[model samples]
Target: MSCYNHSNPSSFLLMGIPRLEATHFWIAFPFCAMYIVALLGNFTLLFVIMTEPKLHHHTSLDLLIYYFLCMLAGIDLVLTTSTMPKILRIFWFHSHEIVFKCCVVQMFFIRSLSAMESGVLLAMAFDLYVSICKPLRYTTILTNAIIAKIGLAVFMWGIGLMTPLTCTVSRLLFCGPRVISHSYCEHMAVVKLACGDITLNYVYGIMAANFVVGSDSIFIAISYILILRAVLSLSSRDEGLKSFSTCGSHVCVILVFYTPVLFSSYMQHWGQNIPTRIHILLADLYLLVPPMLNPIIYSMKTKQIRGQVLRPFYQKTEVRINFY
Candidate 1:
């Protein structure tokens, strides 16, 4: 029996934004700024949801939506954190070396968190569908217990789907030239370095992407279709428009989250002539852009959240007005 040789390669050098080594310092600033915005926006949204009593006891449906939002915020944080810090280090300090085990761990977290974010978006879609279509039974249909169960299932689904991929990659023997061509340890990027056959890894990766992301997107589309149908059936045109508008923010978020992802996936397989720098930029945007924009989209579109966000400013304004 031939034992697997895990000691042949111990680390990997991440090539950040290929061919742009002379300007890594210039690139790091924007990336760092995006990271700060994502962190502050997500944390502020979470704080408003948790601390504001007005936000807490609004409606049963609102509460349910809040739960999903919390889950999403947490997932976005995990997803970005898994890659951005290491990416910053790579670009800023020229610290490109990452231990193999650490690389595997980062890849696992990034994939799993992205999958979980998809699940959370699906859950949010269901929430929107119920609130719009089955308004009468929204609370009964999605009770606290059911919401808890859904969150648990989404979490487990992500972990379960990514476990096999992580395990498979961990077992592979990596030879020399252990350099990853992207800013982070992406699954396929890491797998490409393996000395052994990667057929199983590729097969499993395709299956997982189809099963998790594809299925979630299909369900979200169906939910939105049903929601639109229900909204259009309303007697008052204005009311119908209002109901449809509620989903505008979610639709924007969905577009922002999935557009780059789909593009990146296509580029990965078919965009052979695409520049490596462009591919790496797309990959970074896939992780960073959604987290940075989701909170802003919601705050601007959702009156409830926006109200909470501006309450202090409004109060101070009123105080000044009264003093005058």
Candidate 2:
């Protein structure tokens, strides 16, 4: 049962989707397609934001919104890339072996990026709150320097919080049965395989989740509540609806991102009878669904992004007609 070797501590195997060997290849098709969509969609959104001069010419408040949107797109890219490749390989090629160091790296990026995304969403909520509640002071409140500081703070908060958890997991001695039950390397999944005491690991994991995800969710809720009140107080009903419409895309993205995550976390803790396959499926959706849908949601709901995305095609048609 001695799995650890002092000479090579980085060896481990990933056991992906147990008891589905016959359907692995068939299952991989959809997963691969989703991964491709996530990558292309996020990258396309990033490109549009970075390239569109109109998007950058906005006031400080608008710029902050664009910045957070760009940050969210980047986070979605990293988050999905961290886990999907490994998961796809497991299903498509039966390559379940992942080194311990690699596993640690994947877990770090996935968890850190996720926390950062949550932070970014919270920041977006605040941005919307300012825009809707105090439009006049929006530029004054969120200056360029302040926006930069907020971005830095979000990055630091995620990295700082996840570092201890990663280090703690790395220090544990994993013994025997190096096979991870899930498709990717997750903190809890990896730690559960270790032979050493994991009380601190579990405690720190819970605390990190509460501090990062929990706090972000709470603040987002508060921001929306105040936003709702502000909208309600507006003189015109149409104006109120118009103001609330601005957050529709963000609300959709948040639900897509958090619902599966919260459910998976709950099931892990309380639903002991749930099948491992169900857990794995939820984990995959938690990572994959948001990235795939965020760009589509924003493009459809946000007029500016939609126009920018379509402007090039329209211009091409105009050029053809003028030439003809």
Off by over 4 Å in 1: 1-5, 319-324
lDDT of 1 by residue, 1-324 (tens): 232345547789999989989998898999999999999999989999999888887889778877888888888888899899999998889999998878888988988888898898999999999888998998899999999999999999999989888888888878758889999998888888888899999889878877877899999999999988898789999989888788898899889988888788768767989998999888998888999999999889878889999989999999999999
Model 2 clash pairs are 10-100
> Which residue pairs clash within candidate 1?
none
RMSD of 1: 2.1
Per-model TM values vs. the true structure: 0.95, 0.94
Candidate 1's C-alpha lDDT?
0.88
Model 2 misplaced regions, further than 4 Å: 1-8, 315-324
Each model's lDDT: 0.88, 0.85
> Residue 224 in model 1: shift from native, Å?
1.3
